[model samples]
Target: MIDWLHPSVLLMLGMLPLIWLRGRARQIWQVTLPAIILGLITTLAAGSQLSLSFMGLELTPLRVDKLSLVFAYVIGIILIIGNIFALQVEDRAQHIAAGLYGASALGVVLAGDLVTLYVFWEIMMIASVWLIWRRKTPIAYEAGMRYLLVHALGGMLLFVGVIGYYLATGSVAFEKIDVDGWAFWLILIAFLINAAVPPLHAWLPDAYPEATVTGTVFLSALTTKTAVYTLMRGYPGLELLLWLGVAMTLYGVIYATLINDIRRLLSYHIISQVGYMVAGVGMGTALALNGTAAHAFTHILYKALLLMGAGAVLQMTGRSRMSDLGGLYRYMPMTFLLYMVGALSISAFPLFSGFVSKTMIVEAAAVDYRGVVYLLMLLAACGTFLSTGLKLPYFTFFGKDSGLRPKEPPINMQIAMGIAAALCFLIGIFPGALYAILPFPVDYNAYTLSHLLKELQLLFFVGLGFVVVIRYAGGKDYIALDVDWLYRGPGRRLVIHTRNMIAEANHDVRAEFMRFLAKLQTRLGKAHLDGSLLRTWATGSMALWTALVLALVLVLTLGT
Candidate 1:
């Protein structure tokens, strides 16, 4: 029955019982559900469709194809791993939110029509906000509100686009939508917002680090990757995305280098790494598209692994800033070693997952003769190694001891990290395994000597430069201003200033009106006292005035 049912329904309905379950039963159910989802995902064949009619429209809630299948497979895998990692957490609501969040992502990828996609898209926004709010901190609450507002705006754009598209074309198919009209542009902007493209990306780093430790893992795995999936499905080869992706690759790393929060640092790199997939989608070649899918899959794994490591640090020490963490390798050696695997994988180190996948995008750019794009990607990769591989780990685990000695995270967490790290290495060592699942055939090799040497040499120089600048590379206790600063800083002040100005103007107007009323009252009092008008006028005089006014009105009306 689970296999026959849509994954979204199974996950949404299945997670509710978790609220009533306790202890081991909750843990067992949490882990069992994702496993069941994975099994169901495997059973799903491409071209499978499940549809029903609603409001005279056919809504396909389950539509399986190569593209959707790969995304579903990865989502299912991350859910199982994430649920295992979260076994020790006591909050059932967090688990439920994560489950619904994941179910919403599954719904988006499997949706066969714009209506189904939009429905899931909105649910994803609603469910994910709870993960941030679950932290119950003021900062988390504020961040979650901003996150919700941004996503809500995006959802509105998506809704408008879908409505416009349906009205114009009389179809709701969620397929390749070109950028020829307002509807397409609205849909594309909506996707870009979810993709965390810069100017629209502050919500990610602002909200993700504030989430519950385990919650960040799920947050890292889902939202942007889902956006990438939508882009790959709907807007591949859009030249604008190619340039925007290239800029994001650099913009993210630049900020990442300045970040002190370990999770926040990793969060910026998400934008950086996702830029690769976005670039590949922009290139629009078969090779580029395959590379995009591969990189997205691998990114979810290694990024989650990195966040798990950072979460472990936060859980044990109550500190997430690298300036507050150092010399932790001795106390958390397993954590250190496991986190390094993720670091290397994200850095595109040889025999790592990123080397297999990330290089594909760079290679795609080179093949397309995108010289500027290729060089920028390489530069971004160097920053990735410098910040993530060398800077973050060095400051967190290897730099001067901050006098904090914390033990490793729980066994289930270590197991989850181990599983993800192992998968990263395995996928790197055997690229064919990941490549086999791609929507396109593989004609690429990640291990060619030239490619290997080029990557190694790049990493080598980056490592050397980091060693030279080691003192300057450590985290500092300062906030780095980002695009969000515009709204959080000046934009907020502008609103307050405008509000104050309006209040002042209102006060001035009210005071002036009262003065005018008082003046009129005084004048009337003067007339009454002086017996100049009403007091002095006889009844005959008043009646004669009224009769003359009436006679004038009657004469004017007769003449007209």
Candidate 2:
């Protein structure tokens, strides 16, 4: 029982106070108080691991394995940074939501069993949607509903898979299962949905951009990364992931390229980044799995930093679309610089965090001689460079001056972005610190002449392609369709059409029934009130009776 009171559990248990306080006050203390407690717990319990049994299963609610520790560490770090970013806002609701959100993510990563993991997984979903709804906009409300529905569906699928696994194997363990059955596929589908793989990715861009500035940063770090953690644990070497990952990569890039909204573009790129991690996990080698884990660790930092930078722009300017944003670098130089660091890292530029981590996955793929997979990954990298790394910063900060001058965000926001930016550079320059915590042995070198030259060449050519496309291309429209178009466009129209048909059919049926009733009523009124039909029947019956009696008398006399 004492073992269950590990750091994460203790911090989670402590969240009750913060949740209660949200109702009374909307202050920084409401959020920072919980975060302070959580950070202390994390620092004190860094090397300790704990577990307990529940329901005849040995459940480890707290497992400080190297893989788990890296993510746990990052979640803790992000929580602090996010709190700082949101310090100016007086809404304690967002604060409490962020705390629970961070705690739930940490719970999922540290869990050592399927049931335990599922418990935290569902909690994370609930907590995250609350953050989305904190925006208090009509769009935020609608997007939150869609977000909740999708995650609920994923949870149901995961629960079914867990039950099926228990019934088949008589064990509720969180280890890799043989992927040759219905149960494994069910679990895979659930994780894939959360990972935002292609078709199921509509919820992310739909909901994320609608969240509050600070809320989106928290949202960006957790949901998909947790899915990545699950994939690392449950479905390594699942061949289908390679194809799915590639599909997500291309799909995200294409959609991101066409988007006018800056934050939505970043949301799409999140799917793209997850694809790399998914593909790495599919490779299933120790190095590949480690790469996937490391990439996830770094991806969260850089992505959040980018989102934070974008959030600052939104907070200051009250605008998010690229079309409405331009040349703020002169006014918000620090933000622009910090955002550039994040962008470069994501683009896998040399001496950046992405260069060190993402290369491991690409290298793993190349070593495996997956020709098509490698080619597609390279193309996707180029596409990422085109859409997010180049397009986002270029359009938002460096493009033609739109003549808008907004002051820098509040000091806390700068501190948040500054911390994240520093971490991005630190991880890239000295990857050994990050690599030391990987689940496996660390021997892979991130920097080499050949690797650096190849990456630069790839990025260079991709940049050239972008310039050519922009210059020679006549149609430079800023709108691209995604999988959501199915639901929002044709699907919505079809629903409306079907509803109209049903309503028309109901009206026609009601009118026909009324007409029939009226006709019947007329006939009944004539028969009952006038009594003509009844009188005729009585006269006919009497005549027939008299004729029959006379005939009978004649026959009787003859017989006698």
Candidate 3:
């Protein structure tokens, strides 16, 4: 019998019925199912394990621990929010894709062994690309293709790494690996790719903006965060991640400032914010790891809120570029209000979720005595405020009047954002609620007077600079090229040229073979016509041969 109560199984099962259901039924099913999953996840006790045998190997597909539960609870909550946001969408496929994508991520979090994690990891990639494709635009299609290809590469590396690790050690348990050997490096690279670390990071901004308005909300929540969870589980304390994480924070903020599309701007910040979690994991201290988990949970809520606001703008105005949008706040007052909640939360403003969570990572750097890293992270925080907190909303909602008046999005959309916005505020006000579920005990306080003063000073100056240079700070309509240019430009041309060369060679070989066959046929026809090999003289020749063979047979018989 199937374990219908299994969290992943329940999620997948809920989605399969969506294909056949429609209208009110589908919406109800999708909404209620996630709530149910959330309830189930909360009830799961830590140290719970569900084991089975597969191919003579013991497999634990469900491993409930504090770490996995943290990811599970947040993922479950996001599923509800994303489903409610998408309630107005008639596309069942999109809902199914979002559900499966969340389920797969949850599966990875709960997986007890490397093989189980890899299985869910690959599924997560496959399910997510569809959200991008569901937009049904040419750019969306291309972006989806790129997203699929990058993750496929990551999946391949992960599969090979799993095999190598299994061979190196006679186990496939998913845990912190010793930082040495081909297996470790390969696995780490795979995780980094999914984590959107640097050059492997291009797929995120490339595809996220192209997804359907509602789809981007779910896209924003699950994939990269899941990779961060895996990093915390399997690769924490690897010092290399410390620097790489800081670099991502700066890299994302810079591009986010320059980007034109609203969703793209938000997408880049995903990289920037995830950098903090990555850096925390690298720190490997109890506080840092707790910060990573706390920030991840809070980031999901606030980031989803931010994306939902952007998606609403896109849905109502049918434009995502800040260059094409302005003065939307007058018409979208509620949207503007809720979006600011998220903005303040993400900006790490005092008395907000971001203030409570993001500071922990920065404080972790300080606690570790890494002054240089601390300063660089502080610099990235300034950029975050400049881009995501200031420039994005300013131009998108309050910049020069573009004379476009778009009303607020559907009620379901507002409710979704409300849920996320409320969570951001609640988490901010009640940090203890978030801290209680952390894998480690919490000892740090985020409400310190010194910390508050420091963050306030940083934001104040960043805001001042933006106001002084407001004209130059506005977004211009242009695609900023990133490292993806290598693949999307020259790399694409190389593939086309190689394909053309192969086609030419194939044509020549086929033509030559045809000519050879024709010549052989002609020669065979001539030989048959020139000799008595298969002609009308066969009767007389056959009779003579028969008589000679008869004489030889008689002589042989007599001799014998």
Top-TM-score candidate index: 3
Q: Which pairs clash (backbone N, Cα, C closer than 3 Å) in model 3? A: none
Write model 2 residue lDDT over 47-90, tens digit each, in one string: 45565777787776776667777777788788778878887887
The prediction achieving the highest lDDT against the true structure is: 1
Which residue pairs in candidate 1 collide? none
| Model 2 regions more than 4 Å off | 1-3, 19-53, 469-479, 493-560
The TM-score between candidate 1 and the true structure equals 0.90
lDDT of each: 0.93, 0.83, 0.91
Give the Å shift of residue 541 in candidate 2: 54
Ranking by TM-score: 3, 1, 2
* Candidate 1 global Cα RMSD: 8.5
- Which has the higher lDDT value, candidate number 2 or candidate number 3? 3
Candidate 3's error at 552, in angstroms? 40
| Model 3 whole-model lDDT (C-alpha atoms) | 0.91
lDDT (Cα, tens digit) per residue for candidate 1, span 216-321: 9999999999999999999999999999999999999999999999999999999999999998999999899999999999999999999999999999999999
